[model samples]
Target chain A: MPEPIDFYFDFSSPYSYVAANLIDALADRHIRSVTWRPILLGPVFEVSGNRPLNAQPMKGDYMRHDVPRLCRRHGIPFAWPEPFPIATVAAARAVYALWDQDAEQAIRFAKAVFRAYFANGRNIGETDGVLAVAADEGIDAAALGQAIQDPAIKARTKAAVDHAIKLKVCGAPFFLVDEEPFWGVDRLPLMDEWMARGGW
Target chain B: MPEPIDFYFDFSSPYSYVAANLIDALADRHIRSVTWRPILLGPVFEVSGNRPLNAQPMKGDYMRHDVPRLCRRHGIPFAWPEPFPIATVAAARAVYALWDQDAEQAIRFAKAVFRAYFANGRNIGETDGVLAVAADEGIDAAALGQAIQDPAIKARTKAAVDHAIKLKVCGAPFFLVDEEPFWGVDRLPLMDEWMARGGW
Candidate 1:
């Protein structure tokens, strides 16, 4: 079997939300599984000397228009979150916490968190909001609440971000197919072709 | 008739080079024409608080890998030009100079300049290099060389850049389909859909 595709994402990135929604089907087509690794963009952006998209001068404006249009194109449910690009440490830790117990459940939790923040504008940056999203996904909310604060889980999330940085991941929704990197939701088609052609 | 697509591009940008190579064929498929407006990124970067892709930290590295992959994917001829992200004012001025004499020829001049810099590794940022590329296109060498230095041609290129800034063009290969903006070569697919469906 081929190596599972490595999917790195930040919870607060809307483009990540789009990729999270679409990646499974993409993987399914190639008979590949996915390894969902949640990362925080804060540290990554600092290392890369990049700012948040919404904080950039003209790009911020372009993203504001582009995100909604992308959602409409993909038929993904979306509403721009209030106080966008929130601190996603809580959400990332929560996924790591879930991963320690159940990988499938963790994927569900990650998708739910994305939908809660981007689709419902539920601000998953806070522990309380993320817990609520976990509960809605039929997860044990109390366990997740406690797990996010667990020292081990927090370290796991930190290590994941460090790994992404080490890999030179510059943005959310970054993918690695056997160590070939592809960034952005826009790269999905290209990635699909890459997988289909077994690398060009 | 539907409105023509406005293509804003910088000659030094690799992605813009890709778009410049493909955009005409894309337009032809939809019974559309493109208006290729050459603009310099230096002023746009200043106004947008942006840096060149090759100057950015991790993004620069990503771009180096991504450009050749994209060119191979699209079957476009490409070679990374040394001294990339060069000052393109001379090339921009040359396009404008050609525009004043012949609009269609200006578009040809623009494409040839991109090919010279990206495919042939010519240093198109220099007046002599640009004039040489123009001459290869059967343009009058001395006339085109003098035209590039014309104060009016220089002002025209500057004004075009200013106009792009006024339109909030944040990057190279930005497009406007009836005033709805799309940025990047990646957006060409979306722009095609938008034009096909008459916007979403």
Candidate 2:
């Protein structure tokens, strides 16, 4: 592996789920390494002046048509999880809690959240659904939620968003390999080449 | 059509070309309407702090893998247009200027610009190239450039960016139907559905 890959994802993004499914395969074949990073999107948006894609008439129009086709093409399960545009605050915080303990489980929790929102039509912002996601990952939901609520963990999650702003990130489903940041799932191939060229 | 579908686009983006090509076909089948728009992406990035996909490492990785595959799947001609990241100022300005005189010509000019950058590997920001693009669309390139540079036109272009920010848009190849926004070409199908539902 030339360098380890850093994947900065948010639980609320459908494209992030699509990207997550391919990360391992990408790492194994291209860089031979990968890291899971779940960050809060709210702060990133604040700094970037971006609201949810649905809030923008044109962008929301695109997502309705494109996402499902991608899911079908990838052979991955997908749907517009209910309560269109579920809040991601709690979900992002939970990810902050899961980071250090186990990376694989973090991915599991992340995918479950994606499945909940984009595929299953569940409200990810609520306690029960999120806890259900954690439990599905075999995580101690109560404990993890407790851990996340810790002031330090909460602050760290905020910092992630702040960092994303400082880094000038524009949208969800972003990736970075060796300091080079790739912004969307659509940019996957470009990142691969940069890696093949040994990711500058 | 319940009402005219407002299509938001930047002449500098190749994805818009890809979307524009077949979008008409899809709209015809779904009985939707499309109104072309020309917006400036540079200003959108300026306010949003969003960098190109290649600038983000992870996103760049994804792009390396996905873009070519998408091009192949869509049967749309594509390549990494040279001046890898060309300055799109003039390209966008030209389309905006032409829009006032002939909207269809504006679309043609936009496509020609994409073909130049993505297919011919030309520099879109260059004056000569931009003029050539106008000529290709049977318009007076020099005249168009001068017209867009006028105070009112310049302000109008800037206003479009401001409006996009107000709507919380940070990226290109955007579309809006019935006041709903979709951000990328990938979202065209979703736009189609929304338009269909609106009786477009």
Candidate 3:
């Protein structure tokens, strides 16, 4: 069996939201499993001298228009969050906490958080909002909130970002198929071809 | 008939090189023509606070690897120039000059210049290099040199860049189909689909 593809993403990234919608079906088509890893792009961007996509000047303007058009093309639900690019630290911590207990539940929790921010326009930056998302996924809101504040879970979230940075993942929706790094949801087709053909 | 798709590019961009190889055929398939506009990205990048892909740290590292890999996927020939990202002022001026004389010859000249820099690793920055590329395309080197130096042709090049800026073109290999903007070579597929479907 082939190694499961690693998907690294940030909760606040629109491109990551697009990838989250498609990656599972894409992986299933190849008869492969996917490992979703929620990462904090704040520290990574700091070290790389990059800003959030919507924070950059013209790029921000372009993305504001492009993201929804892309969602339409892909047939995915999309709604711009009211306060764009809200901090995802609490969301990342919650994902890590759930991941320790159940990887599948963690994925469910991550999708819920993405939908809350990108589909429902809810701010995932707040602990309460994230707790609500966790609750929707059948996780205990109070326990998840406590776990998010736990030092071990906090360290795990930090470690995930650190690991992504070390791997030179400067962008969200990054995928790694046995160490071959492919960045962006735009690269998904190429990643699919790479897996299908066993590296052309 | 649909408006000709506007292909705005910079000579120094690797993605532009990739797009240059494919745009014409893509247009032909859709029964549409392309208006190839060579625009300088220097001023656009400055105003938009953008840098060359290879100038950013981690993105630079990734692009150095990604460009060649992308070339292979598209079955296009690519060779990184010795002095990558050479100033394209002379090349752009020369292309504009030839464009005034003969549009077909101008495209031939532009493609030759792209091949010289990207496939042969030749420097198109120097006046002599661009002159040689023009000569290879059946243009007179000395006459082309004089035309490149002509104030009118220089203004044309500047005007092209200015016009692109007015259109909010912040990146190279930007495409405009019926006034809708699509940025990046990765977007070529989307652009193609948009043309085919008459908006999706």
Candidate 4:
């Protein structure tokens, strides 16, 4: 059987939010599933010397205009969150914690967190926001709170980020299919073609 | 009549090479013409605090892999040119020179320059290389050489770069349609849709 597509993302990324909303349907059409792996961009940025999309000068301005237009094109809801690019450690850890218990529920929670931050403008940078999104997903908020603080979950999230860095995952919404890397939400169509044609 | 699509590109960019090969056709599909404006990214990068894609850490590696994959997908010939990301001033100035004399030949010269550097590993950073490409395009090499050195042509090139900076064109393969901005070759699909639907 073909392996599931590896989907890596962070909560602080606007493009990731768009890719997250679309990857599943693309995968489903090809009779494939996605393994949603949450990661922190902090360490990845440190290694790559890359800054958040909203932090650069002209590129930041371009992204601000481009992201909304992209979201509109895809019929995805998006708004620039306040205090943009908040720490995503809390959100990443929560996903890792839930992942250990229920993989499907973890994906649902991740989706909720993305929608909360990007669509609803809720900051998912802090523990409170993470738990709030979790609760809304019908996840046990207190258990999630404890799990986020659990050293094991924190280490798992860190390890995942380290793995991403090792794989040179420089951007969020990066994907690995058949060990081929595809980055950016804009790559979704190419990735779809790659899956359909089995590489060229 | 629809305003011509403003295609801003630099010779040093790989994505620009790919986009340059495809954009005219995309424009033709929408019954639009393209104004191929060659601008140096040096000043724009200075304003944006941006570095070349190959100068970064992991992102550079990703670009190296991505560019070839994209070329293959589009059936465009590509090879990582020796001394990649060379100074494009001479090439830009030559384009301006050819443009004033013959618009169609100027575009043919630009496309040849892109093909020269990207497909055949030719170095287009020097005046001689630019002249050779111009000559290959059946342009008068000696006349083109004199024009490239003309103070008026130099100023025109510089002014074009300034105008791009003013428009916040922070990257190559950037497009401005109906005064709306789209950046990156990945944005080509979106640009097509925007032109088709007349914006959303």
Candidate 5:
């Protein structure tokens, strides 16, 4: 058995999507597996005073240049999703719906949300967007939509965000392998190495 | 001649030194060289709300794991400087003094300071340690010491810090490659590729 690496992610972050793309390979190694703990990144930024990269000219410049190039390196096409930082509330609710019934399905929806925002520039805040992805996952879209409105699911997702803050997560795609948190996607190589040394 | 890339650096920044080590080789084919812009990361942080990696536990852990490994890749030894975020006011002043008289000497001394503080746990903030590095670059220790205390040099360094704040550099080791600012060392490959393709 391998250590379950907990990943704190969000659809609003391009880095999270990039991290999602490589997560399967990470899990397949048998050295570690990902526990996708989707959190709202907005609160993380609020307390930490971090704005979106698009908000700062310097950081924005790096994002436009570096992120697409990074995606290109991974042989993935990329673009900024429209309605940046789309309301992840609905997406979060759907994630909770699949938390137990179907884990792979949950991850699929998560990836879909990320791709819609970062790669396709779609508005994930729209119910239709979330439902379309849910339908594609073979889940009952209407039921999923209703479940998304549940207070318990809302609380669950918010608690994850609170837990992320307690864990000191300041960025998206934060990975914790054996309680050691790696914050940025750029640190993946090191995370891979550390997991390997841990008998991955 | 390649247009000179402005490298905004802070003496206490390990990433800046690591990036600087490769700046030359990466820019070999470019028409512009590098113009070392000594800036204070502290002021940049004051405006942007980014603290030292060590100050932010989660981000700090990521840096500790990722950077030492990158240093190893660059064939540089690794260690976290003791008393992290050692004052660079004095060190910055010394570099400003030597900036015009000897850009190469100034760069060497700045790098030595980074290595000493960030790799060897030595305090470049103090007079003796920085002077020791200056002597290694064949500079007069006494003259350099006097330069450190010069009001003009100190004021110039202050201005540099303020300038970085205005430029919106939120972190250490930001660079401007052909007028496009890249905030982290990880952005180098893309910036280089752009320069290769005339993206600059």
Candidate 6:
């Protein structure tokens, strides 16, 4: 069996939301599993002197137009979140907490969070919103609240961000297949080809 | 008949070199012609508070790895320029000069300049280097030298940059199809689809 692809993403990223919708199916086709690693872009942005996509002048405008168009092209459902680039700390911590108990459940929970934020247009930045999404995935809301605040889970989430920075992951929807880094959801085609050919 | 696609590029951008290799063929397939507009990115960068791709921290490193990988994938010849992000004023001016006289030869000259700088790893930043590439494309070296220095040609090149900025063209390989702006070479697929579907 080949190495599992490392899929790094942040909860607030629409591009990550799009990648989440596609990566699993793509990986299954290649007989590979994906390891979803939820990360926070806040610290990464601070360190890299980068701003959120919507904050950048020209790029922000382009992304706003492109995201929906891309969603339509891929046949993925999407609704733009209002007050975009919300805090993703609560979502990340919850994913880290659930991951320790059940990786599959964590993946499902993360996808739910993405849908809530990107598809349903709910604000995942709010703790209640994140918990509601998790509950929809069959995770107990009260238990998840405690786990999200657990010191260990908080550390794990921070560690994920630190790991991302160490790996030079400057963008969401970044992938590492056999340690070959590929950034952006746009690079997915190349990633698919790379996996099929086992590297070029 | 469709409006000719405006291909906005900066000679110093590797992504532009990659797009330059593919845009014409992609346009031809749609029975559309392309208007290559070589603009200087220096002023655009200054206004946008952006740096060259290689100057950004992780993104720079990723671009270095990606450009070659993409070139190989597209079957386009490429070699890393020693001192990339070189000044493209002379080349742009020469292009504008030749464009005023013979548009087809100007396109050939621009392609030659791109091939010299990106594929052959020659320094087209220098006036002599630009002249050599132009001469190789059947342009008169002496006449081209005078034209490249003509104030009108220099102003035309500057005006092109101003026009690009006005269009919110923040990156190289930007395309304007029927006044719909698309930035980055990666966006070509969408542009192709947009043209095919007559916008979505």
The positional error of residue B104 in candidate 1, measured at the CA in angstroms, is 1.7
How far residue A107's Cα lies from its native spot in candidate 3, in Å, is 0.8
**Interface root-mean-square deviation (Å) of every model:** 0.9, 8.7, 1.1, 0.8, 4.7, 1.6
**Per-prediction TM-score:** 0.98, 0.59, 0.98, 0.98, 0.81, 0.96
Q: Give the distance in Å from residue B69's predicted Cα in candidate 2 to where it truly belongs.
A: 19
On DockQ, the stronger of 4 and 5 is 4
lDDT of 3 by residue, A1-200 (tens): 88999999999899999999999988998888888888888888887778887777788888988999999998999989888778899998988888767999888889989998999988888999999988887899999989989999988889889999999997898999978889999899889999998886
Off by over 4 Å in 4: none
Model 5 per-residue lDDT tens digits across residues B1-200: 66788888887787887987888778676856677777877677666555777666556655676677678767876687776677777888888899899888877877777777777777787878889878877889999999988888888888887877676666778877666677778767767877887762
Q: Give per-residue CA lDDT, model 6, range B119-179, as digits (tens).
A: 9989999999999987787789999999888988888888889988888888798999998
What does candidate 4's lDDT look like per residue over B71-108, in tens digits?
Answer: 99999999999998899999999988887668888898
lDDT of 6 by residue, A87-110 (tens): 899999988888868999988888
Query: What lDDT score belongs to each candidate, Candidate 1 first?
Result: 0.90, 0.70, 0.88, 0.91, 0.77, 0.88
- TM for candidate 2 is 0.59
Per-residue alpha-carbon lDDT of candidate 2 for residues A1-200, written as tens digits (9 for 90 to 100): 36778788877777888897777777887745676667766666665545676665545654665677667767788877757666676787787788688767776787778777767777777767888888877899889778766898878877887777566555677776777777778667656766776532
Model 4, residue A2: what's the lDDT? Answer: 73
Q: Kindly give the stretch of ten consecutive residues in candidate 6 chain A with the minimal lDDT sum.
A: A44-53
Q: Best lDDT goes to which candidate?
A: 4
Error of 5 at A190 (Å): 3.4
Clashing pairs in 5: A31-A200, A81-A117, A81-A121, A82-A121, B1-B31, B2-B31, B2-B32, B3-B31, B3-B32
Off by over 4 Å in 3: none
* TM-score-superior candidate, 2 or 6: 6
Q: Report model 4's interface C-alpha RMSD after superposition on the true interface residues.
A: 0.8
For model 5 the TM-score comes to 0.81
The 10-residue segment of model 4 chain B with minimum total lDDT is B95-104
